[model samples]
Target: MHPLDALDAAAHLAATDPAAAISSLPWLSASLADDAAAGRFARWGRSSVIDENVGAAVLPRPLFDELHARAGLEAAWPVGNAGLLHVYGYLLSTTPTPYGLKRERWLTGDLERACGLAVAALLPWIGAETLLSRATSAASALLARPDALTEEAEGRTARIALGAPLPDGTAALAYAVDGLIVTMFPVADPAAVRAGLGAPRLRWNAA
Candidate 1:
């Protein structure tokens, strides 16, 4: 299984799409080598990202998605902080196999996470702590800079760089500015990727 094939494949129990094209001792540095050549990720950037999520589409698609409305209403939490692994079908289907951060043409994935953050503000700490604790944890990510370049922010905190790393080690990076946090992954090179990979499904293109 190629490293980037995981880019297209979705959640499954038997998915064995490799993370690297060639196995290396330190797996982190080796990840982008293959995918970069094949263009698995649409962009690579180092912005003070506020919300970068892998399977961000797949990560939170179910919650705000109309399909899952019944389940969210039925289940105790999870859609927010109080979610439970279904112990069967859901655990397998929920996660996707993409390291690249994506924007749902319709922002389906973000809805759940935004709701999750709103309900429990403290949950953001989970990834931030992990990024601080383990330097290696963030090395392989799309927006890999764990620390903000700017020394002082405008207000409250020293600086704000919001990140969310899933249990799988795939994470999202968010930038905090003007005392506000927004969730759009920045692109390093606009020409490298397909035009609409990160753009809205319906967008105005200059004629």
Candidate 2:
């Protein structure tokens, strides 16, 4: 099945059965428990690493380990190579923040710094397309709303795409856009859906 079609199916499940939707993600299926995933996302909504001085995002270590394992990366990537910083940056950018902390802080502070560092470190080995795809997929899972195809979501997706070193951001944008479109419009068979939509026009810095 096309990735977007898969996302549509996931979103359809999310409408009535959010747990099923989350569990349907291929990358997340093995290690992450459904209840645990929900709880962890809830913690992300309630907690803040800013006031806590935790140095890392409030996400649990085991969850982070699972994400890395799914990505086929070494454990040392998170701590030694600053992969956690990249994860934190993606989360801060895509996920909603608590009221007290300024979104600007996350946008301008360690979030951007960490993302840049992550791009520099990972791009050489993984290439930009894979890096952005995995990062965005992980972020989409963390947000627990893979169906959010809003302008803001698209913008966040664009930021992630632009962070990579791809020769052209077109494919990256298409992947993100297609994911959003599928989530927003969950049809069992996407051939008709894709025919209706024509093709997703690259909306983010296609140049």
Candidate 3:
């Protein structure tokens, strides 16, 4: 099954039985509504819930991991490597708009930062033609950037450098339009992710 299919299924199940969904899935409820508001009944366990004092949404990593695992995705859909990070970043950073070209709220610094890393990770490996099929039209539209490259080879080697690290160890990689696989340095530690394998470069020669 496709990864998106699994995501859709999980979403559907969540919609049907929210309580059950939370129990079965990996998600934490986030309240975002304003409690001071006049009168509004809040829905529990909703991805996006609005109430008087606050609105809440569910932002959890387990959901992403479970959906990816269920989809039975192959190398073609490596959510772990990049897709998952991107999806998480987008959900947290952007607000859902009915007709906005880019559904994400670009203003949020944290979301923007996470998105920067996510883009850097996926830029090189993501097959353009492939993305068109998986990512929604709006996703594709917003994802479209001048820096995105297209080529048969070296697609995975593209590197975008997110120089220096933020207090939270966040950074962005900027790659040339050419082609190269830009590996996403793990967010856990900047130094660990940068340790090059140092394996001697291999070359093919006809004997």
lDDT of 3 by residue, 29-146 (tens): 2111111121111110011111112232232344444433332322222223223223322333222333221113222233235443343223211333222122222223222445
Please state every model's RMSD to the true fold in angstroms. Answer: 17.0, 18.0, 17.5
Kindly report which residue stretches of model 2 are placed more than 4 angstroms away from their true locations once superposed: 1-23, 26-57, 76-207
Pick by lDDT: which candidate is best?
A: 2
Candidates ranked by lDDT, best first?
2, 3, 1
Candidate 2 lDDT over 1-207, as tens digits, reads 864455446544544554455456553343233323333322211112222223334333444454444434444423311222232222222223342222232222232232333423322112333323334443444234343233334233321121222222211111233223111101223333334543344331111
Off by over 4 Å in 3: 1-111, 114-156, 173-186, 196-207
Clashes of each: 14, 0, 31
Give per-model TM-scores.
0.21, 0.24, 0.25
Best by TM-score: 3
Better of 1 and 2 by lDDT: 2
Name the 10 consecutive residues with the lowest summed lDDT in model 3: 38-47
- Model 1 quality (TM-score): 0.21
